[model samples]
Each structure stands twice: as structure tokens, then as C-alpha cells.
Target: MSMLNAMRQKSAKAERSCVAPGEAGCDPVSDEANGPRRDTESTGSGLLQAVLTRENLRQAWKRVKANKGAAGVDGLDIDQTARHLVTAWPTIRDQLLLGTYRPKPVRRVTIPKPDGGERELGIPTVTDRLIQQALLQVLQPILDPTFSEHSYGFRPGRRAHDAILAAQGYIQSGRRIVVDVDLEKFFDRVNHDILIDRLRKRIDDAGIIRLIRAYLNSGILRDGVVLERYQGTPQGGPLSPLLANVLLDEVDKVLEQHGHCFARYADDCNVYVRSRKAGERVMALLRKCYGKLRLKVNEAKSAVASVTGRKFLGYSFWFAKEGVKRRVANKPMATFKQRVRQLTRRSGGRSMAEVIERLKPYLLGWKAYFGLAQTPGVWRTLDEWLRHRLRAIQLKHWKRGSTIYRELANLGATEHVAKRVAGNSHCWWRNSNGDIKRVLTIAYFDKLGVPRLS
Candidate 1:
């Protein structure tokens, strides 16, 4: 009887060892075709186990804290993370281990666009964000390798400048005809089935894939209602960027396989060819290819234009005497000017000193970002315009004609010039360009330590 019991126990152990991937404890192999899959460190347990490891969760928490986003529908924030996780984390982990984890609905909000419309955004719970971040760190190494070299949106060690330089190189080599492509409602229209299918082609980890699917179907909390999101990646999800890239990578490959010189930053892409005819052909190919993926191109904004006036990564290009030149595009330039105008508004009611302080940081930030432009004249011209704004601020501060004369003279403006300028009540803006320059000279701005774009 004892020998028979021992033999039965050994057989039971074998049955448990061969448990399927979906089960709690199973060692699944990496085969996306039909069987269970594995990530780098699958514990026979799969990506579910790999992602919930202590080290992975800790790293995820660190990133979640560092990013410091707003509260979701739960109203939990980074500051409350440690306290909330004291007991909640273990339960959460257990659910993940048991494959019972369900992401909370994302809080939906709308924000104004720069060009004058609103865009939808979804904010996930801080805890959900932590998990997503952790999962992303693991998947990034696996998926990023397969991405296109020409695509540079939100990837580690990649920037808009990288995309810009790639396009610059292409244009300099004489691919002047450009297909400036734009996607229509990209984030709101990502097809969940297609995204998951593309993902399976690269990663065989079924657990992580299910977690991602849960997120897509997690629903949106908006206006006190839960709306299901069957398709579309939420804009603010930590995992969304990487997921979007997975789909866009196909476009990049299509461009590459077709032998077109192109550069892409997120949804913005520019395909360059040697002639107008080639550009037209590339455009046709993109429309048809994008449709197959259930992606739509913004037909009105998508155009074939010369590299001379074409904009990519916020910089427009044209051939100068030496070679191709790039500068801040018109839209961004107008936006910058509008921002400066707002900061320097005479009716803003801030003192000249306060205005100077506010302008300092804005100017420094703008210069740091846009200073890469090869056009120094635009900067010099912006500097001149900025100083005019400063002078107008002082005039507005004086408010009264008598005070204006007194302040201008005190600031070293000649009495004759100050009197003549202050006498015209309606010429404050007019005088800012006139004799006010004599009062607030470049030397004066230099004394105040104002930032110069040039």
C-alpha cells in the first residue's frame, strides 16, 4: 500500500509541472504562434510574474513618483502612494499574481490645443500608472529593438532634434521633394485588435498582453459616466506611447522597404524624394497602407511640398547661399510672439522688476529650445521686439502723463525727449518704438540682466 501511494504522489507532481501558461504556476515557452509565451525572466510564471517582481515594482514606483502626475478618478496622488501601498500593495500584487488584476477606469478631461480646439486626455490612477510604468520598462527592451531608426517619438535617447537632424541630412543630400504627412485623430482612433496583433508579432508574453488589453477595455470616467474604450489608446496612460509606436513602426517599415528617405517624430512624418512625381507616389502608398491598419491620414493637412517651405519637427527649411537652412516654423514663431506679448502686457499690473523676472525665465527657456535654429537674424529681431515690450511696461506702470515724464527723465531720458513723448497720451505704444528706446536702451536692458535671444 505505501509503494502505491508514493507512485501516485509522483504522478500528481508531474501533472502540476505541466500546468498551462494561463494558470497561476506554469513555465510557458516563448511561442506566439499557438502556445504559451515568455519574457526575458519568465518564472515558468510568465510576464505576469516577471512584471510583479519586487525589483520591478520598486523601479516602477520610483518612476511613478518621479513623474508626479495629477490624481485620477480615485483622487490618489504620488504623495499618498507610500501610505496607500502599506497594505494595499500586497493585495494588489496578489491579484496580479493570481491574474485577477483589473485597472480602474481612467479619468477623462479635455484641454485646449494651441491652434484653438480641444483634445481628450485620460488620467489613470497613480497605482495603475506605477504598474504600467514597470511593465513598460520591461517591454521597452523587447519591443524597441524592432522599431525603425527613422522613428523618434518619446523613445529613450531620442529627441525632436534627432528627427530634425535626420531630415536635414536627407534634404542636404538633395531629396528636396517632401511628403509632409499628418494623422487624423490618431490617439482617439487606435484599433485595439490591430495594436494587440502587432504586439503579439514581437512579444509572446500572454500575461502582459492581457494586462494591456484590460487597460484598453478599462473604460473612461467622464462626466460621471463610465464609457467603454474599445479602440483608442488613452493619451495619458504610461504605456500608451510605446503602444502607439508599435503601430507606427509598420509605417516606418513600409517607407523603408519602399526605399524612401523619411523621418518620423510620433505621428508627424516627412518622406523625402528627389522629385515631385516620387513624392506623389509616396503619398498614395501611405494613404493605402494607413487604411489597411485602420488609420486615417488628415487629407487636408497632408501635402506634397518642396523642402524649401516644408515644416518638420517645428522647423522649416530652405536653401540659403551656403546650403539648406532651417528656422522656427511660422506657427511656432507666432505662438512664441503671442506668449511674449501676454507676459509683457502693460495691463498685467506687475511692476517693471517683476515683469523683468518673469520674462527672464520665459526668454531663457525659449532660447534653450529654439536656439538651435541657424537663423540669428530672427533672434536679433526678437530681441529688439522684446526690449520694446519692456519699455512699454515702464510706460504703462507710470499710467499718468506727469508720472511718465518724471520716470523717463529719472531713468536718464533727456528732458526734451521725455516731455515730448509724455505729452501725447495716446502715443504710449507709438512712443515705445520712438523716444522710449532712448530711455530703455540696450545698455539699460543689459544693466537689468535681461536675456538676449541673439
Candidate 2:
């Protein structure tokens, strides 16, 4: 996974290459049709052949109009990765991609704990497994060679999931304290002026900042607009993550000054400390650093909890019962059916049953989150993709009894609420008589979309 983190740009070309005569064996038909023939122009020198291939080779080209995600940065190729390499480090680039090159030896260092503690930490070598797993799940569509660049993480969805899992793992180990720092708008809210200044502080390379500025100004947007100014790119731009990562690399200095006791990727950050006071001290230093950089923390959505159930990224972190759970509400009969149909279409004609099967893992977690007390089938249309592909059709009669029954039971008024409402009566919970009460109400709405409560 760490190797994946180091791999910033992905190549667009499919993994296709010529097979040798015996190793993978070339195609028999092609081999038989075009047998090797001596060329009078070819020389015996290997260097001569290399020069000829480099100069004479006419690379294959594809039409941008006929393909999806063709309008890449600068209209070179859909793959900007190769170009980025050539521009950034031409010598290293040529040796890596076009010629043979050996990687530098891994560097190591020793570190210490924050809070003026006595513990010393040794910096270990970066491993590939962490990045492999993270990017494998984050970029799952990459498994399909046909997938386009647009399918990449345009938002902080998968990254957030990874962060939550990392935090949850620590909590599950019986750690008594945990503090998660939430940077308010780490992307858009980031101060570019401060970032540029910080970048200069970290690396004396002005060219890198120039490159970053170019990326920021002319990047792509989902609404199909090219950035006309430094900050014109939409929040979902492809270069946003890359640029944000480079900027946050400066934050590592402050982290090291305070202590690099936690792990992070992009804006999804988790600061782990051994003790509660130590955690608070780290948070204080972080707050000071952000203040110095003209950044503020969003404390409302950001929380510090020893026992909380929240979904970080895709991993579920549960201390007690407050972990994050994915949810879907049942729509009206007419609208619900339409939604199921739409979901199926969006999932590439996946059948309803097959869709459900794919969603079972997430849906099962949702069921647990909802405190299943009534409905037997919680996520009825969870697998609409598979269901639609399979041509499975079923009309479900959704009962509103689930919420009413559960709320009443939870409020400890099952007997009282049942007594007040007659047979076939519908009710919702409300605060009445100095206690939770089930107020009779109808689930359906009139033309105004307002429910009638009685």
C-alpha cells in the first residue's frame, strides 16, 4: 500500500506488451505469417538499434473525441503521468521509464515522542503493503482496463474511510484515549499564500511551486470548465489531491516538531497519543500551528471521543454504539420503485438480486445500525443493480410500523402508546406528558407533502 502512495500518476495504456518466442510465446499465427527476416539497414551494435528505435518509432495515437475522459491536462495524452515524469526529473525519468535505473537505498532516521517525553522512535522504511491495500480499495475500478480517469477519487470518500479504520484499530486495542484533528476545508480553505511560503520553507525549489501554480490554475473541473485562475478549479479537480498532498507535506514539519505519532494521507488526519493529557497537548500544538498558518479547526463536526461509533472512510470504528453506518430511507411507493430502477441503471444493468448481493456487507452493517426491531427486510432494494440485470421484479408493500414500534419501545411507552392508539392507528413519537409519547399520525402526505398529525 505504501508503494501505491508513492505512485502518484497512473499510466493510461493497458498492460499490453510483446511476448518473446518461448517465455510467454508469441502469437503462433503472427509468428508463422511474419517470420524474422534480415534487414540490410540494421547494424550489429546494440546502441545503434536503440538510437534507431528512439528516433524512428512513431507512437500510436488515439482520437480524443471518441473516448471518455480524453480532455486531460495540456491535451498531451489521457495519461499525464508520463509527461509529469519527463518535466519533473528528465534524467531520472528517462532512466526509470525509457532506460535502466537502480533505485536509491532506503533512508532511515530516529525520532522521539512529543510532549517532552522520554521515548525515542526509530523511523522505519516505508512499506508497499499499506499503499497497495489502500489504493487497491480506493481505486477498485482500475482493475477494469476500460475504466477512465474520471472514475478516480474526485472527493474525499475512500480516504476518509481509511482514516476511520486506522483510528478504530487503535481504539479496539483497548486504548483509553484518542484525538482526531479535523482541519476545516483542508483543500479549499487552505491558504495558498501561506502554503507557498511554507513550501519555500521546506524546499528551496521554486520550480516545484511554479508547477503547483500551473496545476492549480489550469486544472479540470467536473462541470467541464478549465481553471482560468489560480483557484478557479472546482473542488473535484484531479490535481486537487496531488496539490493538497504536496502542501500538507509542510505540515509534517510541525508534526515532527510536535511529534509524528500518528499516520495520515492528504487531509484525513489522526493524531494518536499514549495518554489523555499527552493527546490534549498534541492537539494544543496542532491548534497553535494551524492558527499560525491562518487556519481554523471545525470543532462542531470534529469530535474527540474515547467511546464513539463512527465510520472513518469505509472502516467502521465503534467504541460503544456510535460508529458510522450507511443508511437508505424507504421512499413512497411510486418514487421508491423509480429510485430502484434508477439505481439499477446506474449500476450498469446489475440485476436486483445481484445488486443486493454486492451490497449485503454494507447493508448488514446498516441493519445493525438501525437497531432492527420491526422490518424483516431492512434494505429491500439494496441490490437493485444485480436485480435489474437479472430481470428480477418484485413489488414490495412497505409498512410504517417499524419506526413507530421501535421508537415507542425505545421510549419505554410500548404499553401506554398502544393503549392510546386504537387498532390500525398510525403514530410517531413526540414529547408529551413530561415523557416520550406516541402521537397518532398518518405516514402519507397530501399535495403539499405535509403529513397530517393528530
Candidate 3:
């Protein structure tokens, strides 16, 4: 009779752990690879009821569905899971409430870095992603209000532009010495102990804590082996960006307490000091603070320089003879030109119309991002350079001198100039800027729907 009574009480506890299926709440999972089940006090039944609901899971499903991405270790694509989520989520929810849900090992992927080498990322399953989104939805509201105003990372409604604006304000305020700092492998180096301890300080829900820990500690599935990660939030995980903000929030405090002018967008940090000596002192303080968090700064890449010397958010700031000015950073501008050159290669089999079609997406996107550039002269220069390339391609398509002459004549080029340009066999690049320039006017490209930067 006592044994029956104990079993009845256990069943009642499980029922109390979750709310009615029709209501909204959370769905959490644990890592099968973790050592033991050491958890904080379980969340009150009231919060669990609020976190774990069919409505909540469905909302998460809608969000994860919209942000379609590569499948996780399960090989289940977002599209493939939508049809089954209805039936599958209920069982998953039951497992979560029973403390038996185990998230699959994360799939390991390596993405090439722009400069060189590679960076690694771990992808979670579609189901896990949905659960993660649900977790993020609840956590963001509670913790976002507590973060530093200078932080403009993955938080809702904050963008890189805000950081840039703040940095510019600091420069204009006479904090011209910029300490360009970056964390070395920040995502992979985030200490789990530090992150979780901080989370506990803000949140007391043990179930939520366990769910996040599972996502962090889940082994990386690479080539059929489960490699355990002792620390660091895995990049590409939905919760990582927020977790990153949480881990780096202390950096903001360190700077603010010291009265240093600084702006941090994720791990890309810039501290502005009035003099070089102050910059040096600020760097020393930052290093000590990072040491406490176990995060390493990329000393090889970090520098203390003038505001004009460093690039922030793809724009370079310089003090012109008149006042401060902003322009596209040198490296990005060069890269944009390189991309245009590649796309407009005369050797490509694409025709003039096809080439314009191919270039539209890139050109339009570039113009949209850089349209706010303070220097209008750069756009005019880019416009001319691009037209020159297009004219060269059209001339190259004509191939022979006679063909070039006929095409140029058809393009409304004068007889004397057309003949002179066609006969110059030196190179199509040279001939392109000659009489052909008159024919391939800005209006001609405008008619062809070729997006012009200017």
C-alpha cells in the first residue's frame, strides 16, 4: 500500500511539471554526454506552465521555419520537419517534462575565413532550433533590459550602425585615439562556468538552465565521432549570440566604470582615449578584465592608433581639411572592385544582357549598403570605372577589328573615331575608353537596367 502511494505521488508530480497541452510553455532537452544530473532548484510549476505550451512550441516552429538553414546531425531539413512537427513535438514535450529529453550531437562545419584559414561552427537539428528559438523568446525579454546600452550586438532592434554612430560621437568628442580590439576565437573560448554562473545570477529557473547547458555541452558530431566541448558557446547555435552578449556584458561595465569612451558590437570592440598614454592604460585594463573571463585578445591584430587609421563597420573615418568625413574602407572598396572585375570578365560566356543580370544583385546590394557614404566622389568614380568595364566587354564580344567597327557604328559611334578605335589592336581595354565611351553612356547602362552606384 505504501509503494502504491509513492508511485501515485510521482505520477502527480510529473503532471504538475507541465501545463495543459492547449496552453503555451517551454520544451527543454539535456545532453546525454554530460556527466551527472546536477541541477539548481527546479523552476516553480507556474513558470514551467508559462514556458511549456503547444502554443509556445508552435510559435517557435513558425520562427525556426522562417529562418531556414542547413540541417543538423540528424540530417533533417527545416522543410522536411514541418509536416511531422505536429505529432513529434508532443512526445518531445513529454520527454522534456519527464527530464528524459536528450538533444542530438551538433553537426560540425568549417567555414572559410575571408583573410585566410577557417572557422568552425556547429549546427543543431531543426527540432532543437525550434526549441532554442522558444528559449530565446522568453530569455531575451527578461535579460535584455539588464544589458548595457552600448551593446548593439544580437539584441533586438540594435544594429552595427548604432555602434558606428557611438564610435563617431566619441571621436568627435576628442577621444581620437582608438584602441581597435578583437577577441581571438571568442565564440569557441566562452567559459561555460562563467556563462552559467552569470545566467544563474539573472535567472533562477533550473529547467531552463539545464536546457541551455545541454545545448552548450552537446558533443560535436564530426566524421561519426562525438567530440565533447568542455567550454565555449558553439557558433551557429541560435542562443549563442545572446550568450555572447551575456558573457561580454562585463566588458561594458569595465569600460564604463573607468569612464572610458567605448563601443562594443559583439566581440569587435573600439575604445577611444584622448591620448596615446591613455590608450595604453586602457588596453592594460582590458587585458586584465579579459583574463578574469578567460577570453584572449588577438594582440597580433589589436592596435592603438588614431581614429583615421582604423576601419569601423566598413567605413573609414578621416579628419578632412573641412571636418570629419566617412568613406568605404580601402580594403572593402578594393574587394568590391575585384568582385566587379571577376563578374565582368570578358572571357565569361555570358552576353552583355546576361552579364548585367548577373551583376544587378551584387551591385544593387552594394549600393544600398554604401549609399549613405559621406563621400559622393567615390560613387561617381565607381560609376565611370564600371561603365568602362562594360564597354570593354562589348568591344571584346565584337572580337575582330571589322566586327568592332560594325558594332561601334551600330552603337552610334562616328565613322572617323570608330575606325580609329577599331584599328587599334593594342587591347580592348584601351579601345573601350576611346570613341566607344560616347556610345556606352551612363544613360545606355541606365536603359540596360545596370545598377549604377551613383
Q: List candidate 2 segments past 4 Å from native.
A: 1-165, 201-208, 218-238, 257-260, 274-277, 319-454
Each prediction's total of clashing residue pairs, residues at least 3 apart in sequence or on different chains, is 2, 32, 6
- Model 3 Cα shift for residue 306 (angstroms): 1.6
Model 2 scores a TM of 0.39
Give one digit per residue, the lDDT tens place, for model 1 in 1-454.
Answer: 2312332344334334433553444343333322223333443355655665556766887788888889988888887756676647656655554445678899998875442346789999998898889889888988888899999998989988889888989999999999988899899889988998998788876667767877887889989999877788989988999999999999899999988888888788999899999899999999988998899899888899888776786688878889888798887788788878988998889998898898898789778777779999888899998888887777777888898888888888788998887887466677789877777899899999898899
List, residue by residue over 1-454, the lDDT tens digit for candidate 2: 2211223222212112322122332222222111221122222123212211321111111112122232232333334433443343334322222212222111122232111222211111111111112222322232223222111222334433344445545565555355667777555465656655654454332222333333333333323443233332123333345445545545555675664445565655666556777767777877776787666788875555543433233233333355323322222223334533454343354543555454444334433433322222433333222232222111111114454345455535566563443222232111222122222121211221221111
RMSD of 2: 18.8
Please, what are the lDDT tens digits per residue for candidate 3 over residues 1-454? Answer: 2322332334445566554433434433344334212233355344444455545655776788788889998788986666455446556656666455677878989985332246798899987887788788778998999998888988899887788778888988888899888789998898888898888888876556766777788788989999988888888878899998888888888898888888888888899999999999999989998999999989988899999989876777988777677788887787788789999999997799999999999899888766667888889999999999998888778788898888778888899877887898448898788777777788999999998787
CA lDDT, every prediction? 0.79, 0.36, 0.78
**Best-fitting candidate, scored by TM-score:** 3
| Residue 136, candidate 3: alpha-carbon lDDT | 84
- lDDT order, best first, reads 1, 3, 2
User: Runs in model 3 with CA error above 4 Å?
Assistant: 1-40, 44-59, 112-119, 400-426
Q: How far in Å is the alpha carbon of 23 misplaced in model 2?
A: 50
TM-score per prediction, in order, is 0.85, 0.39, 0.85
